[model samples]
Target: MIRFIDLGDQILEGQSEFAWWDTISDSFEEFSGNQTWPNWKCFEEDYLLDEVREMIQDMRPLDRYKSLFPRDWSGTFVSAEDRKKRYEKGICDDIIDEDT
Candidate 1:
């Protein structure tokens, strides 16, 4: 039973910028009772707005951030055999160290 408010005129022409605040307020109320990790009701509107505005202002284009990493960065995967070998080696090393 999610209910949304009609921001009608508040979303028109010169009012659209501030309309986000009302939208956020409505969403906060809508989800406040749910078992969400971040309880939106715990935060004040002004503080949330300030933090959101700052985050938006500080955001860079995704491609720009992506370009900072290696283009050939695909070595994070491991085969089943490699994982099994590593696990066996770890167990063997632990047993040897314990014996010593």
Candidate 2:
């Protein structure tokens, strides 16, 4: 399961590392689940950074798509861009399997 921490950390259960962006440093950090080298920073040149960003980007659209209604339901409507905003505010929790 994918879990999001209050500090914008994305934790993938059973995975050795978790991804998080550091706003103050303007960089990404990867923390080991085993608490080994807790301050390990993942640089832009790291392949893992690119992979995690791509994975997050790919999953970004799913929330918006799932919000769409089929035919005549008149409920609150949220656009794709809105979904992005919600994610920015840390209001949306999207769970993904490790295989994904």
Per-model TM against the reference: 0.21, 0.20
List clash counts for every candidate, in order: 0, 0
lDDT per model, in order? Answer: 0.32, 0.37
Pairs clashing within candidate 2: none
Q: Supply the TM-score for candidate 2.
A: 0.20
Put down candidate 2 lDDT per residue, 1-100, tens digits, no spaces.
Answer: 2222222112432233323344555555342222121122322234233445566447543243223312332223444555667777888865333343
lDDT for model 1: 0.32
For residues 5-100, could you state the per-residue lDDT of candidate 1 as single tens digits? 223223333221111122334543311232111211222233334434455335532233234433443323433454566668784332223332
**Where does candidate 1 stray beyond 4 Å?**
1-58, 83-100
What's the lDDT for residue 71 in model 2?
Answer: 34
